[model samples]
Target chain A: MMQEIILGDYDLIPDTIPSEGELHLRVKPIDMVTYWRRCGAVANFIANFYRNPQDEIYHLNENLISTTFNELIENAAKYSTKRDSDIDISLKLYNTILKMEVENICSQKHMEAFQKSMEKIIDSDNDELDNFYLNKIEAKHAGDKDSGIGLLMLKKDYSLQLSAKITPIEGEVYRVSVHAYYNMSVE
Target chain B: MELKAGESILKYNSADQTVTIEGSMRLANLMEYDKVSVFLNDAATQASDKLTLDMTKLNFLNSSGITTLSMFILATKKRQNPKLNILGTALFAWQEKSLKNFNKLWNEVEISIQ
Candidate 1:
């Protein structure tokens, strides 16, 4: 599969897939913006991998795709400043939903706060998310830039199932992955 | 304008009566403009009663930027202190499209497209 969509230095095209039907993207920070600009490259690669005989196309809304992926890269750039720190985006189709996961190397302390923010955003309903967004804005007045609202906005806007996991890499490097499930079955 | 530097490249522009912000406000670091937010708290500030924003260079703004811009406009109306004039100059065709797309969410704000 590697030979099919050979991975490039900056981006990996649909290049072949693994036996488990997972598509991997070896993404760089600079290519992150272009990666987002070309929406559905992730989901499309997955759909092709799973090869659903139904010939399904995951038509992710432009706005939703742009917002979620932008957040992913923004966080990647925010955290991955150290050597060999890069963002890894993986796509897996579990059931009817397409799972989009973005992992980056960041400070361990920031991971705890990032996880807490994800949990709060995942648990929040529309009204709760709205209130949280507004409260964060108000907090800005007190010199508190609650960056968590970016995660909350994803929850409020797309209403996707979101989560994060922290993994320790070689040489004491840390990895934080944020995942969001998009329902490809939606009409 | 009150320009406060964010962690790195991010800058928050508050009310400053003297300086003038020309051209489009582009959050050059990230493709998503939403990461940038504008806050207008006090009723009596040096900022424009009716502010004119030049979107000549603003390519794309994310949800956060949109929400923040909306709040700035809301604050302008709620306080009713001065007319918050929102204006944009589209440098590229896409800029015009973005302003049009975002303009819908900002019905409450008095905005003009140039």
Candidate 2:
């Protein structure tokens, strides 16, 4: 699966496998605007796929999924160096946990920033997350915001276990794959 | 003033001092948010006593758009003119969680989610 899709060729084709409690789709958005729209479409699909009468978070599920997916897609599109590179996205469901991974080629600077944000979010407690988020919002008021805005919200607001992995694809070029894990029921 | 494209709409009624935003808002970039800020600033200047934003139908708002909106609210809060009131009719789960954060910007900023 990896060799055929990632190593050989990926032509913006979306793939899916229907499971008792799982669904997967993939897309390589052409540009920033398309990426944003694609994320919404994927999020909407996942939310509805999991919609059920017995679920307590029916109303909140779709929004949360879409928002979190948007953040990931936005980050992938914003930091990627290879606009032509494939933005390989996959969604997997294991019971109530929904995991999303978006892999794309990015500049070294983008990799560094992702690593830094992951560290801060990992080390900070809930109270610190609250204070830090408010501080960033205040910075927005000052027109001095940073890339950590979306990163922080993924952990603090959406309660996603966010992490980043960087593999050297070539000189000064890195394949950065961002992973987000969410407990749909916990929300 | 009104701006609509695709599934999004941002309308400002100078007479009632109300701004209604619907559908998704992922404006081209922060530069576009600056244009939105200018529109809101002008609308605020003409407001009678308050500015109410109906965002129930607004589905998705990217990080940049969120920041732009926070800046808008903060600027209005500083003016101390039209009272900042947000009618968050957002039924989406994200809106309920995200919109509440705006109250943290200004204690005086009233947010009613119906």
Candidate 3:
């Protein structure tokens, strides 16, 4: 049976936008680890693409966009189920709004984990989200690697609206699409 | 002691009891960050009075790196030894926003964003 799960402000993701700039990148999960610099490289490239010299917030926005993109791409690569499957990334800019989408193949285990994390973020108010983030950091054990702090930081620190769409593909595999919307105008 | 990978540098100077991190750090996973974690832990332990982390030049740190720093702070808090001070640069928006979270983990942590 095929199942679909949508979390967060999925409706806010536009069907189409007349983007001023667009970039698409695809990479395999295994290669991401082998060449870790690719994440930062691609992120800087995207930030430079949208750079405006006249804008007073140029440096800040550049750093912000690059950091934001790096986290999203890194998470997609880290959580992907198939090491050889490609993680697809798409970035579009509509005026001052930046839209990013990363799609990756995930096992049932990862899909559920991703869903649970997204639900936690979507359900929390400002104070609850802040506390949850702090608790997650404090709760880290030596063996535990990721606690979904990057996504939470995006929500809590950057005020980014994040969403995810999970669709079962076959057997225990699924396609997970993570979407993020950032308004560049905000200081 | 120092660890250099790609464009990033993590160096600890025992003389001043300061650890300086520069450039972008997007290490693969927690295991990859172990060396950094160990270096920080050692620095925190060795400092006589105050241990400072000079992150003013560190333009980028991935979430795993952040976790490593947080864990170090938490451990230092538990030990109740060498006071912690983080020197951050205002050039990076992330520093302005995320570095403050360290104080939340340990209120006594002194953070200066210049």
Q: Which candidate gets the maximum TM-score versus the true structure?
A: 3
Report the alpha-carbon TM-score of model 3 versus the true structure.
0.94
The deviation in Å at residue B3 for candidate 1 is 15
In model 2, the Cα lDDT at residue A164 comes to 62
DockQ of candidate 2 relative to the true structure: 0.46
What digit string (tens of lDDT, one per residue) describes model 2 on residues B44-105? 88888888888888887777777777888788778887888888764776677777778887
Better of 1 and 3 by DockQ: 3
Off by over 4 Å in 1: A1-23, A29-58, A81-83, A93-96, A146-148, A170-173, B1-59, B81-114
Report RMSD (Å) for each prediction in the order shown: 10.5, 6.1, 1.9
* Model 3 docking category: medium
After TM-score superposition, the amount by which residue A146's alpha carbon in candidate 3 deviates from its true location, in angstroms, is 4.8
Q: List runs of model 3 lying over 4 Å from the truth.
A: A55-60
Against the hidden reference, what TM-scores do the models get? 0.57, 0.84, 0.94
lDDT of each: 0.51, 0.71, 0.84
**CAPRI band of model 2?**
acceptable
Give the alpha carbon lDDT tens digit for every residue of B1-114 in model 3. Answer: 888855789888999999999998888777888888888887777889799999999988888888878888888888887899999988898898799889988999999999
RMSD of 2: 6.1
Native contacts recovered, each model:
0.12, 0.51, 0.67
Error of 1 at A77 (Å): 1.4
